[model samples]
Target: MVLLDVEGMKCGGCVRAVERTLQDQPGVQEASVNLVTRSAWLRLDPAALDPQQALEGALEALRSRGFSAQPRQSGVLSANAEPDRAWGWWNQWRQLMVALVLLLLSVLGHLAEAGTLSLPLIGTLPFHAGLATVALFGPGRSILRSGWAAAISGVPSMDTLVSLGVGSAYIASVVALVWPAVGWPCFFNEPVMLLGFVLLGRFLEERARRRTGRALKELAALQPSSARLVMADGSVRDVPVEMLRPGERIELLAGDRIPVDGVIEEGYSAVDLSSLTGEPLPVDAGPGTELSSGCLNLEATLVMEVRRVGRETALARIISLVEQAQARRAPIQGLADRVAGRFCYGVVSLALFTFLFWWLIGSSLWPQVLEVPVVLMDHGHGHGVHQSLGAAAQTPFGLGLQLAIAVLVVACPCALGLATPTVITVSSGLAARQGWLFRGGDVIERSAEIERVVFDKTGTLTLGRPLVEAVLMSDDPSRTIQLAASLEQTSRHPLAHALLQEAQRLNLPLLPVQDSRTVPGAGMEGTLADAPDPLRVGSLEWLRSQGVEWPAHQRDAVEAAQTGGQSLVAVSLGHRPIGLVAIDDRLRPDAVTALQRLRSQGLSLGMLSGDRRQAVERVGQTLGIQTDEMAWQLLPDQKLERLECWRQSQPVAMVGDGINDAPALAAADLGIAVGTGTQIAQDTADLVLMGDRLEALPEALGLARRTMRKIRQNLIWAFGYNLIALPVAAGVLLPGFGILLSPPLAALLMALSSVSVVVNALSLRLP
Candidate 1:
């Protein structure tokens, strides 16, 4: 996968175009583009990919589509050092500042006419007209040229409609100034005001985008530029980190960031892993301890041999994964993009109809149409001097032109285009902070659809390792303990450890047995020599099936242990129950609360375990799990089958941290892994709990659900805002009521509409 910092993407149309271009290239598995961040993340088949070739090919493709792009490389895009990034932001501010000055000049001209005041050598008409002309051809040149060129190319954008709105207002004002016989109003402030508002909104949106992408940017910033390369002669030289190859030894100093993934060769230090694990505590590192890139050496200088540099490092992989995940679109986002694709043409056509309706029809019926359309606008008619243009706003053509301009300026597809991508990017970052990492937007969508979550028994819901809970026997059992310890001392199972530890705690000595032989499923058997019969230790079922009578005295204790969901290892002397040991894993402190919270949110929860029915029931009862939701003694294949069955009814999420769970994880609709799990399980999971906390699971689900909600809200606002604002901009209210939206006001509202969607998405960060 490769991540590229893209530039010149103005809207969602630009995102779609860039994606289409990149995905069409060879070896490209998928291409996801984010309009908000102006970034593109690409997935490729490594077997067929040459990174340099693929990146160059993509850059050329984007260039053909009118976008500038470059693959993100470490040390090149530091916020303080990247000239292009700095200049990009500075350019936006400069344009907006200039537009504000031009707007002020235009406003003053209107004020001069309204108050019948004169200033300097320039009169009202020339002064206002000059501001409008400069605003169009000067500060607004980029917008006007892009809009005009897009329209000519038959791929009009939001800028195109804006250009038309400002241009029409300028042309109308010029006619009123030059050909006064046409009886038109000279509203020169409209164009200047439109430019000012659009630029301001764009600047703020860019700032929001920068904040949203701060995490990925921070990740890139973690890459160090220099490393102290330790030579074979025991001398150190400062060299560019990238210049150091694998197998080279480097000297790491206290307070210096590890330049690459490597093993510590000598000395000791505390490595801070906050960037990767989200934990603030530093881990102790010594000889042979593996250190990943992006960690800081907190103490003592250590000599280390580099293993992986550049993109192969863990830090680089994390950044790439996050960027790719954020770039991919959710299913709902496609709807907004489709609407935006045709939005420009639709608005243009609608504006034309608005003009024809008011001029040819409505102006004749309503006397208000004979007056200026907007009340905020002043016609300068009260000034007795420049009455040469006739009664201002008395003509139907002039009033109709204002309505048309309003429609053009007010209809914005930018909001619809931004509805999904912004939220997804922000949500991805937010999830990372909470110690959960999603592989892609598809996982987030799948998470939101989850109706049932299956939890693995041993390590998932409970503390993985077990502790002895109780010991039951039909007799004093000292001999039983001695016999059981002799049979199980050599074994390394959890139960065997428990038995050996118990005997040691009691200071009991083991008696050696001769002719010892191991049973496959049953416990080991041997001639006790001292005992009256051959001793046996295994599961109660195995003993019972072998004709060993159940001990009456220990039956109640056995029932109690079974009901408590503990593992039982029974010992027999000549088929008579000698002793029983109860062992079970402890429940996590947060497991109950987490499960309760999940249930409250309408998710069905279940326990998937390989434990027997009695043991599984005990844990299930304590965790508040219902009988139907518990599946016990299931093999790995059976667990996969359970997932399939559950998924058939509704989307199922399987949580496990074992290699055995990998198959079930792959089969489920969603798989969540504890980071402490085996590499196979974590690799199979769609999302990882990096901190290995159970509570973070619910946090992830909640974040996904909230992200979906934000997407829906933004989509609704984008669609509804356009639907409502478009007709109003077309003077729908002008016929019955005297309400008319001026082009300048329309532009301001349109600019705000997109900003509002972005702000709303940002609000998801709260709570």
Candidate 2:
């Protein structure tokens, strides 16, 4: 994926043009342009073309089409760095101020013409014409140039409409000033008012967009620029964070943001992780505690061994994910994009139709409108000022031209383009802060539709740290445990940890094992060095399949273990039963509450596990899951099949934290991985809970629903505003109620339409 910062995009039409430009390049598979972020994300095919050449060609294409394009800086920390804009906020503010002065002078000219003021020089046609000229070539020059360039490139945008409206009004007034015999009205005030309103609206809209992206900015700000590197000789030197590498030691003092992901080697401190996890209180940390980048060391000085740095840091990954999420288009957004792609052309055509309608037919049909006052200056006393409709309508062309300008300026394509991405961008940042990382907008959409959630047994609802409770069916219990621990020592299964811990507690020596192998969702088996028969250790079901038999007398022990909610493992030698091990894992502290919360939200809950039916049933009863919703003694593939069956009825979400759960997770409608899970599990899942907090499951689902709701509201407003505002601007209401929207008023409404969509998206940031 290639990321580029693109400038000069003014609306949905611009977004479509940028996207089309990139996607048309050789080797480019897909291109997405975000108007809110003013960035482009391109996916390319490496086999078709060299990536470097493709990037250069794509940049050249954008430049040729009149956009300012450059490669975006790599790394999450760089996102906080401001881009160098030729016309920055201060320059834009100065331009707005200039336009404001011009607008005031023009308003004064109108007031003087109305006889409310006695300023002869200010009311003169040449004076107002000079003010309009400065406003046009000064504050509105960029808009005109960009709009003309876009039109030449065959991709007209919102700027094109504004330019045409303002330019035509100026030129027509200039013609009247040069030759009054043409019978045209000279109203130089229109252009100045239009530009002033456009500038003001853009200023406010830019401010609101900045606020919508605050969460991403805050995340980028959490990484410190430098770190204090601890030398081999115990001396410390401050070094740039990017220069640090794995195994290098760093020193952190109180109030310092952690520069890299590391493990504490010495000292202790309370670190604030609110920026990463949204946790309110600072967490206590000691030696050996794992610390992620961007957390603040709050209470004491500490030394850490860097494990990950630069783009590999947790903070960087979060930022990248958020950016990718914002770039992804939702399904509903496709409709908006399709409409916005041709919206400019359609609006231009409508404006032309509006001009022809009024000039050719409506002028004669509604001649009464000509006598109606165009401004406050029109009254019983004829002032002979051309500002009044009666004077301007000396020819029907004047009324038609005025209404056409309103139609052109009032139709907005930016609102349609911004409707979805702004919401997705805001929600992505918010979810990152809350410790949930949604893959993209599509995942957010699917997550909102999930009607059932299935949880894995171990390491998901359970603490995943089991302990050995009893050893059975063996004359020498110590020998049985030693044998099992030797085979399980290298495994990551929770039961393997239990057996190793038991062996450690008993201080038993493990015999060396060879030719060891693990069966997923089952057990481990290997050969003891001096043993005549290979020692096999696994679940009774797995061992039975291996020709090992359960003794009739030991049935009582197995029953007792299962009734107590203990998972039992069988040990066999040469197909002879040796012993059974009972391991028990406790439930997570928040499991019960989290499950209850999910159920209360009208979502059904289920549990899938490889444990015995009795143990699975015990957990299901405790969590209030129905018996029919619980499946036990299932292999990884069986779990996937069960998930598919559930999905046949409703959208199902699988939550798991183990490698065995990866298949089922990927097969579900939405896959939610626990942060404590294996890397493969996290990689396969659609959403990851970074804090490993089960309570966040409900929060994640709720956030998805809320984000989708906000998107719907924005689309509705965008579509509805255009539907109602366009016709009114074209004078559809003029014949009925004599209500015609003026060009300046149309400009104001158009600016507010885009701003309203952005402000609504920003509301998701609120509580």
Candidate 3:
């Protein structure tokens, strides 16, 4: 699979166009284009067997289809380096500037000719006609070209709609000027006003559109440009990061960024991983510790051997994931895309029908059925002497043509095109800034439909770190623990950490162990240097296998703590049971409140764990989770199977932070990863909470629901606006109330519609 950056993708229709172009090519297996980020991730057939050839073929296909595409990774071939680019903003600004001036000129001239004021060369037929001509072919030239291209391609865009409307108004005005017998109302300012408003709206919308990719751009910019290369003789040279290969040594100083993924060979430091993980805490690292790119080294000088470089580094992988997720289409967006795909064709057909209906069907009717009044529009230029001063003064053909221009001008595709993508882009950017990652709009769509949330106990709900809750049933508890810690000296288990931490706290002596061996699912066994018998620290069942007897007095407390879900590790010396360690993992500080908030929304909540039944039940009860909703002692696959079963009825989201939970996270309808968790967990998750706060989960959910709501509302308004405005522009109400929409008024309404959608989308800033 390869990721490519695509340009000129404005809406869902553009998404379809690019995908269709790429997918139809030979050797291409699939193409998914994202409108929000202007990128395409393509999967190709392995049987074809040539990456360079395939990429070049794909690029050529897209370029021919009027698109600009290039591989995001450096050194890859882009068949055409200079794909057709639209006129730059400076040109657009110049066009808008000219259009604005001409529009003002026409307005002033109209006012002067209306007998309200005096202004020279402003509102005459000759001057206004000349100004309208410049506006049509000048500032509005790109719109006309793009519209014509889309129409010829059989997919009219928003540009096509505006082009037709503006061109029609200008043509009608010129004909009226050249031939008085046509007797049409010559409103030359209509085209100038329409181009001015359209250009200004495009300029503003493009600026907002660029902001949607701000997070991705920032992520890309985080990569270091150079690294301190350490030579074999201890000499150092600053070299470009791309020149460093795996296994090369690099020197990192205090306050310097780690240039690539590497393993430390010397020194120690507290590295600030906040930029990479979204957690504000600095992590302590020492020799033998592995570090990824994009971390800041604080307060130490260290030397490390590089392990991964370029796209293979963790930072690059994260950037790639974020970019792809930004592009992934949400379920709601698919519905919007389907509509946008044919939206232009529908608008054009309706405009034509309106023109025909007014000219052929409604022309025969008189004042009762259709009022063609005595008034002249004054046509923005002085009316001929034969024209009346009262309303509706044009001939039937002239009235019909005027209404047609209004129909074309009033309908806008910009609202529909901008509706969902703008909101998705802005909301995703907002989520990124909050230390939460919404992988794709689809996750947001699924999150909005979430009915059940399943959480993994260890790390996800609890801290995954166990503490010594209580110690009992022995004359010499400290001695028993010191002996146990000796056996667990090399183990990294959470239980081992609990015992060792307590030993370290009291400065207990640890005896050396010889012939230490892991019992696998039981515990550990080893011989102390001075002891004749083997020392064993393991489960209660494992100690019984060695025939160790437990004290009767401690059984009740053991049962009580077990019922409360504390982990028990028994110590046996010379085949007799010694004192036990009661260890338990505490729940996260915000777990209860976060769970309560989710429940308040009427969502079903559940927990899954590999812990014993009693332990799982105790934690579930404490968190208000019912017995039926909780699953216990399950393996990774079992957790996945359970999620698959639950999702059959409703959408389920799995939250986990362990390597064992990666499968279930990937299997669920949506997977949310806790940032403090394992790398595997973060990779598998569709949504990631980078902060150590569980409360942020609820906020992320609300944001997705709200963003989707905005998308739906925008779609409704866009569709409804056109359905009602098209007929009115066609003079549907003319026969009853003699109402006909003027072309200039229709142009203003069209511009306002685009502005409303853009403003509504921007309103999705997190509350």
Candidate 4:
């Protein structure tokens, strides 16, 4: 997948155009454009695509849209780099300088008229007003051009209303000057004021937009530029990761990303798998072990064969998942679209009705008695023909024009289009930086509403790995372990590994054994050369039938192991009882903290595992969950059944990491798959946690809540602005309360709301 910075993108249509252009290129599997960020991301077939050439093609597509395009060298690959800050600041400064100059001139003109100026030359008011016009028309031509295009096309965008008001006001003023009115002249200063004020808002909005894009920039910085490839001669050479191939050996240095997923062919070390699986534990590896890409090599040098490289690697695929998820649009943005589409029609209808009502009133005798006659008598109209006509037209035309300009200015719908999506975009990006992958805007919205959470035991609620805790013997401990090792050596089960590990720990040596055989369901049977009969390891019933009496102390140890939710393995030598080995699984490091945070969020946390009742209960108690909150001895289907039952009452999110948990993952309202689990579990889940830490689940939930909050705020602001401003711009309040907004003023308000939403979203940092 590739995300390239592009230029000149302005709206949804521009985004669609860039998307289509990039999709036309061969091997480009998918393409999306973020207009706000001025970027285009592409997923492609690596075998058929050349990265450098693809970027060049994208540049060509952008140029066709009338904007300069090139690969941003500093942050070309990262989604989190803010190399665009320099350009963003430049864009801001250009707008600010023009607006500030205009503002100074307008304020000076107003001050000069009030006799506040000491120097007449410095207060050359006409020249300042004309200079403001030049600033508005020349330096700020992009806004005018975009607005004019939308207006001419009859789209009636936020741009259209602003253009209509500013352009009309300024042009009318020029007309009034070139051909001075035979009555009171109109003022063009409002248009200048609108441009200056709106530009100030744009400057604020641009600063925020640039900050939001930095999340992507930071993500891009994580890529490792070079890898140390181990050559056949046993020497290492630094090479670019892109140049590595399948079957080639690579040596990982400490703190380096595993360039590709592969098997460890040599070396022994503890590897930090947190970055890849989110698992906090460092896995110790020796020869003939699997190592995934993006895992940090934390110990001795690791030699691994590259099985998957470039885009086919696990790290690349995960990056793709997050980038795709971040591009999803939120539901609240639809409200903006609805408002923008109908705003023009609604406002025009009201304006027409107002005009008709006034025209009808003019035809009535009321205009002569209440308006025209009053004006004529004030100017003493009987004295001159010019005097009568000027008084009749001057006051009314000037006031009506001013009111129309105000209405058009106040009707800009920029906020209606920007509010919700901008918030979603910025918040989602912030969440992504913290390692939460929100599948879509709805997940962020829905997750915030979750009230209950169900956890799968084994890997989720407790540490899943079993360890040998104790070994008890009825006979000589050495003789019993040696015999037990011989029997267990032939069996394949988790209990077997525990037994053998315990035997090894005791330094017990296995005597030469013959006729060694494993009874599939029963256990194992084998005869040592020194033994007079076959040694057996099976159930207590089989041992009793062999005339073996259970030792009292060994019986107590077995019972104690069961109570602790541990596996008990019994061994026998000849016809006599021997020893017992107790093994149990441990809890994860972050389970307690995760549970506490989820509980704080008002989610009822419960544990469900396939382990025995005692084992599951042990884990729940250790994590501070009450006995009523734990469920055990559940198969995959049973887990799903429990999840379904809970889902009926409230939204539930199931967090698990094994294949057995997949069914429940699918059944839950939101399936949070941990990164450390099996392949099937990762594929089956709806939302994959990039790390193995259960703590991330609550972190993600917190981030999701923030994102949803921002979305709601943005939607409310956008919707509220339209609800209030649209009615006033359409003159709904004019007839009764005389409240109306000009087009320039409407545009300014719309832009302010849009910028506010984006700024609010950008405020979500990792508190």
Scored by lDDT, the top model is 2
Local accuracy by lDDT, each model: 0.77, 0.84, 0.76, 0.64
Model 4 ranges with Cα > 4 A deviation: 1-96, 105-129, 151-155, 182-186, 254-302, 344-394, 472-492, 500-515, 527-547, 552-565, 605-642, 677-682, 724-750
Ranking of predictions according to TM-score: 3, 2, 1, 4
Give each model a TM-score.
Answer: 0.83, 0.86, 0.86, 0.77
Query: Could you tell me which 10 consecutive residues in candidate 2 have the lowest summed lDDT?
Result: 375-384
Q: What is candidate 1's lDDT per residue for 1-767, written digit by digit as tens? A: 67778876677666666777788987788887888867777877767878678778878877766677877653234344368778877887888999999977766665566665576633467777788788898879999887876676556788888899899888888887889888676777778888998998888887887777776677767778899999999999999987989999999999999889899999988988777667656789999998887789998999999998986777766765677678777878877777787788888889888789777897787766564434432233434323312133566776677778888888888898898988888888777655567877778888998999899987888778776666676467666667788888777777778778778877898887767777887777776667658777788888888778665766776777656667788888786777787777878777899998899889999989997887778788888999999899999998888788888899999988746678888888898886543234226888877654687788789899999999899999988998988887777776566465666667778888889888988898777
Tell me the spans in candidate 1 whose CA falls farther than 4 Å from its real position. Answer: 1-4, 16-31, 41-61, 70-81, 116-118, 222-240, 243-259, 262-274, 279-291, 295-307, 372-392, 463-584, 676-683
The ten-residue window of minimal lDDT in model 4 covers 381-390
Cα-based lDDT at residue 357, candidate 2:
90
- Estimate the lDDT of model 1: 0.77
Question: What's the lDDT for candidate 2?
Answer: 0.84
Model 2 steric clash pairs: none
Q: Could you arrange the candidates by lDDT from highest to lowest?
A: 2, 1, 3, 4
lDDT, candidate 4, residue 271? Answer: 87
